[model samples]
Target: MSLHLRKPSFVLISGLLLSLAFTAISLISYYVANQSLNQHITTNTLPLTSDTIYSEVQRDLLQPVLVSSLMAQDTFVHDWIEEGEQNPEQMQRYLKAIQQRYDAFTAFFVSEYTHKYYHSTGILKQVSDTLPADRWYFHSRKAPEEFNINLDLDTANTSITTLFVNHKVTDEQGKLLGIIGVGLASTTIKELIETYQSRYGRQVYFIDAQGKVTMQGSQFSGASDIHEVKGLQNIAPEILSSPEGSYTYTNDNQTYLIKTRFIPELSWYLIVQHTEQSEARITTTLWINLTISLAVIIIVLLLQHFTLGGYQRRLEYMANTDPLTGASSRHAFEMLFQQILNFAKRQKHPVSTILVDIDHFKTFNDNYGHLLGDTILTNVAKVLTQNLRQADTLCRWGGDEFFIVLPNCHQSNALLIAEKMRQEIEESLQVINDQQLHVTASFGVAEYSNDETTVSLFNRTDLALYRAKSKNRNQVEVATESAFKTV
Candidate 1:
């Protein structure tokens, strides 16, 4: 049976149907676009905010503490305090001398017999005060002698507070002559965060490994509790257990980026957070606004695609590229190594790598100047590129070390490639203005093992390189079977 539908009012029906279809599409597109905008904000902005916060804390607070710790362990300070207690005034003057070395400290003190102490702030306080029962100084003088932190209570008031770090000062006979206390103002850290916030418009927090908030950014009006943010707690456990990590979350429709890094100096975790609203919102809005103003949006995108995109790409290349050597930088090489490892796993092939470091590089640089050394590196790079096949890659792993990745290569092939690279570099010596710059490299080769992870594989190669250097330079050494058997 053939059934045919009647189409008497075709024009009217068609118009009504088309109008409804267009309205539905318009509503759906708007809904989808808005949802995407929200997701984009959540995914992108929060992470950027987290990174900004983390970097700021690291650059400002953690770095200073590290520098201070280095200065604290200086030989000069140790030698100056070697004098006995009979010369108490001399000891006081010695304290003054040490204090004068660094401008970072405000109050400096040495505690000998708990009560008998010598204090000096030659730059700020003219006459040093030896006030007893100083709660702050006494607290700093306590045991667990590694690092003593105490709040200065005597010379320290609410407004002008001081944090003290006391490290034991020992005599030549290894006798404890007292502890050296370095007073750093709490306000200095406060001002640091303030300055960082002013520049980056981000909030910073100095949280310990246990997720306790040590310091909060003055710009932050949020709660002081470390556990205030659920996302932070979840990340804290994993990141504190490991090296560094980041987490993103959304709260009250606002995106937050939280990044945590362990600051080795003060044994603290530096947490940084930023509002990723600008990048996320702008990118999303521009995409949505594209439909509304298609012509203008297209023009803007094209302009960015050509100008800003190209500029950023070029900057990234410069940053991750060795200019003179024409090879990838250490960072870029690591990225490539990971990619190659992944490919090797997927293809079920062996991945072999080598690290070659130039021998006597410093001597060459000192004798012929850095300009000739750079030229030598360039020539070495050219030789490596010329001799090696396209399948293999060479990168500037460090100043004078190059990493070579040979995918799907066995141990025999790997050694051959490493030796050939060494030979090529040695033969590529050039004389720049009567200065003979000869280049020779020591290589460490390693073949991929089924049980080895990517990180461990690199470590093995590094160990081999160390062995090669130890056994005299300008040679190739494969990682010992016993060495990697355990790994």
Candidate 2:
């Protein structure tokens, strides 16, 4: 053969052999991996997800129990029961407060002696053992445990399913006096399941020891009995007998892994489900494989980044920003103060601080009402912010008081800035809630001393502000007036 023909033939043979070898090797590895992954998912992955869901559900359900326990031991409840339940309005108001504060679906107390059921709204009914609706109260009364959590419709109010936590109350001598507790709506539990499902891409439901489906999210059928479910019926008996275990079954020609855990607090089994592992698709070409893998990796990273980043940003904003005055929060200001101080020390620059307190603010708040009081605070902050340099940090140091940090500025310059801010606030005519008003503030300016800490600097400035208020209401004073410096 000629040289060109020989070369072409040799390349064709090499390519065929390479492709065949790769295909054979891939088949063996793929089969092995499928077995291992299925084992791993059944043993580790699905169970871990079940455990996480259990922990989150337990935390939420246990809170109502804790609150019910507190209500049971409350002195007011003890006193009210002993005094023959004289004030129904007071008890109603107390229950209302509990419901509103905790955002519970229902809050109630049933008197053992009188057999009366008092709801947050008013008296719902009188407890009687003969009535089917009041059997829960009786069950709670006879139960050995202090409390029991039940999922059922709240008959007194809307028939929407509610998780009721009924606790027994006792007197000083441990005699039964009443049953007290709160109810949580099913929406909360449903939302919890949906949240986890979105993250883990799994199905979740709850079942009792008797194989009865007690709780389930919107995605699952509201079937009352596990024995009714097509494939689940086969293993239902085995699962109902155990506290925790795993099982697999075929439904619609597809196998699913089920991980079950018993929650003693709610006396319910949490079941998390995952579909059986399938073989991964095989693709030829290293370039194409790399491209697909990179695309998938990017998507997963972006989702994680956004979820975590959004949460972190929200937390930081809430912690560091003042809601009312649009200034940095006290905590945020403290952190910035340390950073500014260190920068000043390194640059050999001056850092001055100013404190502004609205004169007669309490009396004004009392006279004009808190709504107008908040308006004045916000207005004062706006005026001060307008007068400040870009380097300055303003903080709502508390009610009617504002603190400012001026970096790379001397006390004299800070004094000028403070006086300007004070005068502008006094001059600006505010038309608040159809009422005309004028406001004045006392200003205290202090120069940072290297020997001093933040507290020392603040104390000196506060003393100066006190002097300004005592001497003349709408004026500025410097820390130099007190001659106070850190030793």
In terms of lDDT, the best-performing candidate is 2
Poorest stretch of ten by lDDT in candidate 2? 281-290
Model 2 agreement with the true structure over 367-470: per-residue lDDT tens digits: 87555787899889999999987878999998899999999999999999998898788788346677777678999889998767788888988888988998
Give lDDT tens digits, candidate 1, residues 1-487. 0111222234335445544553454344445554564454344433444544444434444333443454356454454444233445544565565556644454354545433555562222222235443544444445645555554442423366565566665556656655555556767767766765654445776767666777766556665555676555555567678666666766667867666667664567766675555555656644453344333223333543455445556667867888668888888778778888888888899989888888988888777655567777787778777767788888997778788888889878989878887877777564545666666888899998777787788778988999889988888999876767666
> What is the total number of backbone clashes in candidate 1?
6
TM-scores across all candidates? 0.39, 0.58
Candidate 2, RMSD to the unseen true structure: 13.2
- What does the lDDT read for residue 484 in candidate 2? 62
